[model samples]
Target: MKLTTKELMEIIPHRQPFLLVDTIEELEPGVRAVGHKCVTYNEPFFAGHFPGEPVMPGVLQIEALAQTGAAAILSLPENKGKTAYFGGIRQAKFRQKVVPGDVLTLEVELIKVKGPVGIGRAVAKNQKQQVTAAAELTFMIG
Candidate 1:
């Protein structure tokens, strides 16, 4: 299913300036999600991150990934109204710089789930299909 920004807000609690994913292109409720983040020079982080050479923070990319993962797990009927908290991050790697005018394709897949905890595999890629960052994210639902 496809989700607009407003619909995304229903599944994930985030707002402008902090809401990273603009749209969800694909999703499988409690399993996986593919989303997008369009990078622009107007982003507030760009100003402090660098004066002239701005790059999206690696941490933000990871957060975007987590949010996308949240969309998947939290969409479940049993999970609605719940929040996901970061439990851990594993094997995170930044492969390239994400700059202005780039549309980031974020893909997150649920790898395992047990009780209120789960793990997801996430990756962010640019328009050219080059991986920008990747990591295994662990989260706990509450």
Candidate 2:
């Protein structure tokens, strides 16, 4: 199912300036999720990341992917009201620069899950479908 930003706030405990995902294009409960983020020139990070050359921070891209993954896990009935925390990151890679006016598409799939711990494969792409970053993320449900 698709979820808007307002609906996402219910499942993901993130607020503006930090709530990177704008909407979930698809969701499979604890399996996977595809989401989006619209990058704008006004993003606070742009000012310091570079005076005139603004690039979406690689960490934020991964976090966006993680948030998408969280939506998948947290949307499950059993996980309702629970919080998902980052346990670790692995195999992270940045392939391209993400700048203003780009609509970042994020996809994350749960590859393994045991009890309150889980691992997910995630990737972020720009509007042109160019991968901006990718990584394996581990999470702890609390």
For each candidate in turn, give its C-alpha RMSD to the true structure in angstroms: 0.6, 0.6
Question: What tens-digit string does per-residue lDDT give for candidate 2 at 1-142?
Answer: 9999999999989998899999999999999999999999999999999888999889999999999999999999999999999999999999999999999999999999999999999999888889999999999999
Poorly placed runs, candidate 1 (over 4 Å): none
Model 1: residue 27 alpha-carbon error in angstroms = 0.6
> What's the residue-level lDDT of 54 in candidate 1?
98
Clashes of each: 0, 0
- lDDT of candidate model 2 versus the reference: 0.96
* Tens digit per residue, CA lDDT, model 1, 28-135: 998999999999999999999988899999999999999999999999999998899999999999999999999999999999999899999999999999999999
| Model 2 segments more than 4 A misplaced | none
TM per prediction: 0.98, 0.98
